[model samples]
Target: MTMSISVNARAWMAAGLVLVMAQASISFAQNSKDPIPPKAPAYFPSVANQYVVRLNHEVPALRTSKAFSGIEDRLGASIKEVLRPDLVLIERRNKETRTSALVSLRKNREVAYADPNYIFQALKAPNDVDYSKLWGMSNVGAMVSTKRGLKGVDISAERAWERTTGSKNVIVAVIDTGIDFTIPDLAPNAWTNEKELGGVAGVDDDGNGYVDDIHGYDFVNNDGDPTDDQGHGSHCAGTIGARGDDGLGVAG
Candidate 1:
């Protein structure tokens, strides 16, 4: 007897086989243990700008001379009355002993006490503290805006420097974020001619009509010593005036 077979019989047979294989694979997978859920991403803590008070004086001899207990008691009493619950007391000694009492103040208090001049005088008496000496000053740490890496010299400033390594007399005002003058690369560029002009505040000393513009002015805050708080201006400054030939980031 003659048998009639469909032209697509082979295709249909192949499809059935494939479907059976797929179902078997799915069943096997389902019988296996469930995959472990991906671990949650790690959390990064945010940094807040807090005021630091650096005492110019060395640590008091009294701290180790059995007098600390009384001071601590007095401090505890005073703190209960007026200090913030988060206040911190720290003592440090290097070439000199020093103490720092830190308290987080409200925005109004910060504004009232953010005077760099006052902070400078408080830390360095007679001669104003140079940027190089900022680390030594009392009640001074990294300013909120100046916590980032130091501002770099910009290309234009480099060309300016090529023309003049900066006349120990010429002062360039960085008007953006406060400068990180402490950086070794930019240290030389920091304005050092304190004798030429006083730092910018509200008082103009050289009759330049701009007060305290000793180094440069911060148009953002209307003050002098336009150090970068953010680092854009610093980067620009780096491009313009960073010491070239130094094995670091792209040179100016």
Candidate 2:
């Protein structure tokens, strides 16, 4: 009789434990929250009607080839410019979009790769009248408008200046829009070609093939005058080589 009672007690305890576990699981499920979904990346549209295509092999007769001509007809695209024997610039017809044309070109067996012509822009910090506004060089955890800056998140120009300010021997060429060397701060550090500076007017000094390129030649206009028509190049030049410790505006 004692042995039978002991077995019945053990079975009762096991049933109770299972019931407790099931209740705990239900409580946890009710308290738990759903997981958050990740955000999708931002999309940038490609340039209209233009695609750059490169072939698996050099197709010298791309302009006149029947196979390429049929592919162009199917996609409603035409060759706009011949960049290379294997690479060419094509324009999609009005009926096709940039994305559709890119997909069609990528599907072609002969084509190695194809992409839309994406535009690019120059990136730089905004130019302010005061030096304190140049936070990228020396951020001191100060608040600006609604944003508070984190200290030590700068280029640490202060520490770098202890070693050396800059050397005049180094010449940095700003290849963007053009540099306005005539600016007061920029004029002092501008690279001057001695041969062109002292050479005769309307003459190609030093036989460099550029006429009177005293500072630098403007390749855009194909002339010696490299004045900054757009402000981007001058801004970049100032950031790279502005005169320091002169009670001036801002140091590079």
C-alpha local distance difference test of each model:
0.32, 0.58
Candidate 1, residue 241: how far the Cα is off, in Å: 0.4
TM-score for candidate 1: 0.29
Worst 10 residues of 2 by lDDT: 1-10
Give one digit per residue, the lDDT tens place, for model 2 in 68-140. 6875675467877667666667778775766666678789887766776554332222233455766777787
Candidate 2 segments exceeding 4 Å error: 1-129
lDDT by residue for model 1 over 1-252, one digit each (tens)? Answer: 111110111111011001101111000111113342232222311112222222212223443444434433433211111112222232212122111222222132311121010111011111212322223211234453656323332122222222223233333443455556655546655554353354444556567554565555666566555556777766545533444334433223
Local error of candidate 2 at residue 38 (angstroms): 46
Best by TM-score: 2
Angstrom error of the Cα, residue 84, model 1: value is 87
Clashes of each: 43, 0
lDDT, candidate 2, equals 0.58
**Number of backbone clashes in candidate 2:** 0
